[model samples]
Target: MSGNTGYAEIATFFRRQIADGTLAPGDSMPTQKQVRQQFGASITTVNRAFQMLKAEGLTAARVGQGTTVAERPRVAATATARLRRISRTGRAYGPKERSVDHQARLLSCADPDVAAELDIELHDEVLVRSRVYMKGNVRTIASFSFINPRGWAAVPESLSPEPLERFWQEDYKERTGRTTVKLPERRGARLAYPYELAMLKVDAPPNAAVPVLVLLNTWHDEDGPLEHWQDVFAPGLWDSDEE
Candidate 1:
């Protein structure tokens, strides 16, 4: 009661409890009302706490089932921890741990499939971003991003090293002067190719003959498509990373 009670703080407390196994996996947590009552906090404060836990994948809620503890999330080490789990588990993840290399070149857009997904109008302006990623001196990944000209019209000169979601959140607020930032609803991806392999400078092993990861990303506004982009990165490059 005397300690911090902010949304992030409450969330952090719940996360530690879950991580330490004090709150076992699959266990139901107090309802929003109950938490508020127990902590002498506002309902919004309690909800924020739950949202924090949800953000970290430490809790779940159902319309009729109320709220419950989520299964423990596996912790990993690297640039992006959640991404590491996503690479291994294929779950939705946020973009973090990525840094822009000032020396990288921006490429022209070419892939027809990428444009189709974005629903870009014929001859419409678009932004194509390409970069080759390296870990120290070793080339590790290549990324290509396609953005609708209008959607990214306010594209900044740079992006933060934070995860993509957080970056989008901050960027949208900056570009539109609005707090609401609509992100992509669906995403698709695939493995890399021989050309991709050469870009990464890593030899593809027998089973790893494929490039690495060929990713398709799309963003949408309330009205419609904002972006459809593709990225290629070395396989297992994200395996050991985390947020």
Candidate 2:
């Protein structure tokens, strides 16, 4: 881990160890000197590896505390479970979690991403729902659901705080004269902004931001896109496959 890719290599080594439970939460990471000696890397290179882990919210560092694996809630619920529940019962969280708070309202579509996904013009009024899901006292994820234009008229319940299953079908058939299809989704990850971290109640010590998982789901039909939902999952949400 000492050449041009030393930083990335060292980072991935520790990342894998953490993922597989070789490094448990609250367990101290090897000191920078130890890492540099083991990897034959420069001090700067070793620091970069630690920085990557910190930014990802996988570890924490302090003057006396050094660096330790960050403690995280072990909620067994998966994203697929929540999606299935939403499709069947319109609930945001699966059986393993619960909605702690929810807010819903109609507003002009100010987000360009949402407009592109829903194939709608900017400034068009649409339904927006914000929710925070929790497992026991710990937050599991924070989500924002944007209902496309069709659901506004046909499924007025989209404006309510309550979750609605198949909110697009009644309107899809009326507009396209056909049944709706499946919900297309995409997942990604990026460093969370300061405000978002506060909203999700995350702490990223020694760094300004933490990593987050993003889920973008679309409910569309043969005619075109109908409704788009963006779910922002909080840090430390364990994916069984990844583990």
Candidate 3:
């Protein structure tokens, strides 16, 4: 495969192996060195393949354990499956409404992934929202968002648990006199740590990387800027645009 083809192919090859039952759960996969030998690809290419596998819930990596198969498959979500997914990056989808609590118990748990990069004490004050997204009866995705306290605190307490699209209708009007909630095109961001990967429920092969879309929103409060930040992601959903 061409270099540009490497990432997708690496993802597909392992997926095929699983579909064909050639690589079952708990089965060890070929090492990166071995895959490179077989495919004549670079270490980075192999790593990308591994990332695809992880994102698909095909494998897991541990320092001493190396990369091994995952016990269950990662459920790939359809575009329609993402109806309830929340983007922390303060972007709005459409106008809607709901009831929410003002002083919600937004807790910050201990995770090594976000610990060093952020001040957990600060995180303690950030808003936390969690929801499970589904398509029909099957659960497609589960998500949680952490908002910057300063800006999040400004949100009208009545809309606490509603989807961002619905929440922002009154959200914007209250924060700013304008009702328009426009956002820039998205630049994809990957969750930075293994703990974050766990939080996102992503699984991939050894050396697998997580690719996510992190949306950032700046809530305007009449006169000026409010530092509100939100993050949204569905770990293994919507890869090819086919679904």
Among the numbered candidates, top TM-score falls to 2
- The weakest ten consecutive residues by lDDT in model 1 span 72-81
Per-residue CA lDDT of model 3 for 1-243, tens digit only, reads 444447678777776555333565567888988888777788898898898788766688877778877654223322221222233223221112122222234666354333322334533544556554443333334344444444454565623565454553366466745543333423366654564455445666656766655444443344343333334445654432211
What is the number of backbone collisions in each predicted candidate, taken in the order shown? 12, 0, 10
lDDT of each: 0.53, 0.70, 0.49
Q: Regarding lDDT, does 1 or 2 come out ahead?
A: 2
Cα lDDT tens digits, model 1, 105-152, are 233445666667667645555665555655335455566556665545
**What RMSD does each model have against the real structure?**
11.4, 11.6, 14.3
lDDT order, best first, reads: 2, 1, 3
Least accurate stretch of 10 residues (summed lDDT) in model 2? 87-96
Which clashing pairs does model 3 show? Answer: 54-203, 54-204, 54-205, 88-230, 88-231, 88-232, 89-215, 89-216, 89-230, 100-158
Between prediction 2 and prediction 3, which has the larger lDDT?
2
**TM-score of each candidate structure, all chains considered together:** 0.44, 0.57, 0.36
Query: Which segments of candidate 3 are over 4 A away from where they belong?
Result: 1-124, 137-165, 168-181, 191-196, 203-209, 213-218, 223-232, 239-243
> Which residue segments of model 2 deviate by more than 4 Å?
1-72, 76-79, 85-96, 163-178, 204-207, 240-243
lDDT of 2 by residue, 1-243 (tens): 555548888988887566545676778999999998888889999999999989877789867989998765664334454554455444444333567567788899887889888888998888888877775577866777777766667666667787555444565476657676557567889887675676678877756767777776777766677667666767877542222
TM-score of candidate 2 on Cα atoms, chains taken together: 0.57
- Candidate 1 lDDT (Cα, 0 to 1): 0.53
